[model samples]
Target: MNMPRPLIPQVMTTPPTAFPARIRGPLLKLCLGAGTLGLALHVFAADPAPVPPATTTPAATATAGAAATPAAPKAGAQFDWSKVPPVTAPSRPGMFVIAPSGPGYYSLWDVVTGNERKAPPVSPNAPYALMTNPAFEIDYRYMEKPGYEPDLFDPIKRIHMGEDFLLSFGGSFWYRYMRESDARLTNTSDNYHLIRSRFHADFWYQDKVRIFAEFLDARSFGQALAPAATDVNRTDMLNLFADIKLANIKDGPAYLRVGRQELLYGSQRLISTLDWVNTRRTFQGVKAFWRTPTFDLDAFWVRPMITERNQFDNWDTKQEFFGLWGTYKPMKGHLVDMYFLSLDDNRHRALGRNGILGDSITHTLGGRLAGDYNQFLYELEGMYQFGQYSNQDISAFAVASGAGYHFKGAPMNPQAWLRYDFASGDNNANDGRRNTFNQLFPFGNYYLGWIDRVGRQNIHDFNAQINLHPQPWATFTAQYHRFYLANKQDFLYNAAGAATLRDATGQAGSYVGDEIDFRFNIHVDRHQDILVGYSKLFAGNFLKATAPGVSPDLFYVQYNMRF
Candidate 1:
């Protein structure tokens, strides 16, 4: 057996508690900002100006990059694979059905944020009319439509059952070359290749019942260090679930799904599919949801599926996860989301000053408000957690806020946004109370700078982002981030939510550093995309005081194709 190398960032076991004195001020400001965001949206929605039809923006997972189809594309569908509430996807696109808000794994960025940089291109790779229009890789309902052209793969994509049954196929390939200099300020460098591929089969019966199964194979090669758990999960089940209609709603049907699957929630700050990793994340459980034009609701309970290289994976019986989420669209281009998420884990064992410890249980309650009004947009989310870990009390909080402006017709179709994020940290290690916020499961790569030197724990980030669509087939993004420790005495967390460096005393200073990142995306045609990115981090006083103080640079090129 190969020893597992440390992944870039894994969820932290240190539960956070307390309301730090330093974060209180910013907390108040963020609270006010959230309220203002809601009010402003209300005003815009109430405006007497003639309301325009809901704009259909390219959601994060909207397919693009294929050669333009000679035939005009069909009207795109709004159905997605996310069980959570996402901000994009047309508000009232036909009758609602069981669709993902936006499958976190299928999208490059946070689909919940409506942040896709370019309009999707028409699909030309599929011969069947069912796949003529590009859709997120997870959506298979299109196959139910009766249509076909002579093609080997087309038959596998749509096989008719006796009467109402239909079977479909879906899959994709993602590859990347990763290289870094002075990673973690260790004054070391390495280059490696990562490859992750997936295939799935979807079977449906009269749109009332279904079975979906997906398989994954991920690998890493030519690395100086052993591959992390995230890099290898050879021949494993990614998703295997059964769905049954519970009731029929206006535009769709409510569903109760059971088995192994993935979970994604609003903003994906706490619960996500963890798609950035080679193997990604999944769980064995059940989920129930109903999607409609006016509102959406979901509930679920599950155990995280453990990934094992060269072995059959199974659910970790020691943990339990459950959540409830609801989204309301009060007016066009605006939405509100509320959720409650909790986890119970028996994984951590430690000795207190006294005896053996107990299990860890944590709960998170939060809400988000977001909207797009006349090229101005904003998103705000806040979460507070209280629980028990190893007999210690836990209390923690996190907030993320962003405001941006979109230039629809300006040069380069540019968009600029300013964002701020904060998470609490524990002041004393042995204080019996933890304040460092556990990130849970998240798409940390997108929230923090891509250099991945930091995480959404014990940190404060002031960042700015600019996105540009320079051509029909290309997009560019640039970002600058300034980071500081929420509590100078807390540990400095890596993007994986693990504490790699710390200053027990408050003397090292809170300044973590600055990071600049740039990325370019190009679409060869519908099934292929190429991405190039570079990131540089400037060492701050905190590192100089605690470690080597060496800054790091990272570069990567990625390719993705779906079939």
Candidate 2:
């Protein structure tokens, strides 16, 4: 009799050498320690005695073995061999089996029945997706199967606590080059190079508790230019959070999390982590999450983390934020979201009757409805704000709507869309009332334009975009935008939440500008990406009247890699 060949495991022989210089030493040490600890735990956690494999009657076993020749099973007596478990070799006194239980080993029944079983599903290759695996592996495909016991610190088949602990680490390095001509409608032309590095780790125990942490380092080198509001943080702690499972609900689960982390909501028009920036935004506080098959809810109380040029950045206690966001799916392809948010800032400045600055407290209520039907998609959202700003009353509102269609069988699989956005502005400067809408923290570049010269405050934007996927890993986008001030008396705000070009006299025309943008994105593989884009803004009457309107142009190229 010929025996089947035993499967050999694949292991990493050397460590990766692509990490940034600053973190290479620490990261390498951490990984080595984790590997050693995992092996030790595996060896000590295994059961001393192995259980015997299932068996059948002697006569049946003999007959099955005799019929297990190369020939197929008999015609009328087909048997379902899948129901028969595989047989294993009896355990030796002190020998251990490192391999897991899988289909490589077969039984006499399997051979006699001549039934082929289906293979297991393959895992995704993406870095983010692979991070969920319990064991760490250089190649994602070689990672251990979901339930395979590495023997790692797990007790005998207990209830919920039988699962082994998990540890994983990953990081990314990104470099970008940017050039701006007539920067921000000014006479100056500026150029710069930016480098960013991030390292993160996740530790989970028994599927009930998780501790995650991430660190970031961002720097710039090149010609002297005005510092960008989003890109200058040197080194900081990005995220450090703990999540604890509370209960197993009807169709989903509930969790409570505390610490500093990222917050993102639908459309990102009101809140987001702002990943495009070199230094992403984070919040410090607590959040409660509950979900079901048809609906999900989140409630959080957090303060935005303030970024400083120094390393020791802290939460801004002066600013307090709280919100409740809920999403419900009424049907297969439709979604509705409702949210209420509040902001209490002792230092918030509001425009007064005579150009004075006063503190502000604002509350916002909003809802969104989105759906996909066939090849068509549509979304609509509206928000209203009311509160007090010093001694003045606050009343503001905003509305956004968009529609798109995908050409399924087209040459390039193109998607074309149109959008319009409007935010209320202060109509009477001397009425002791403020009406300019506040956008809070949002991903401004995603909705507006790549240049991000205008924000979602007292503004009107009309945009059209076309997206094409020429290949499975590449995308191209072209967009055009027309901008105007919702009220001529109000100021023009930029993505940084700062007023860029304003006319105090309210004599400038409402037209802000028109912009054209082109972008290309290429995914080299699961761990690398390349992005390039260009944008040109044609100054309109208002811009020309307030600042140097030389038709500002911007170009950027960025490369990213993950491990």
Best by TM-score: 1
User: RMSD per prediction, one decimal?
Assistant: 10.6, 19.1
Tens-digit per-residue lDDT, 159-188, candidate 1? 655555667777878899999888656877
lDDT of 2 by residue, 1-563 (tens): 22111111111121346333433444354345434533433343342222222111110111122111122322442432211111111111100101111232122223346533232112222211111111111222112223331322122211122234555566678888999998766778989988888777666664477777777888777846767756777667677777788876554456777877777766577887676788777878777775554555677767788887655467776776777776665565566677778777767476677777776777888998875578676778899998777677889999988887767666665777788989888868789788989899877876777787888998999998787756434557788989999988788888866777788777888998999998776655445667789998888889888885467888999887765
The Cα local distance difference test for each model comes to 0.65, 0.62
TM for candidate 2 is 0.73
The segments of candidate 1 whose C-alpha lies over 4 angstroms from its true place after superposition are 1-59, 63-137, 140-155, 349-358
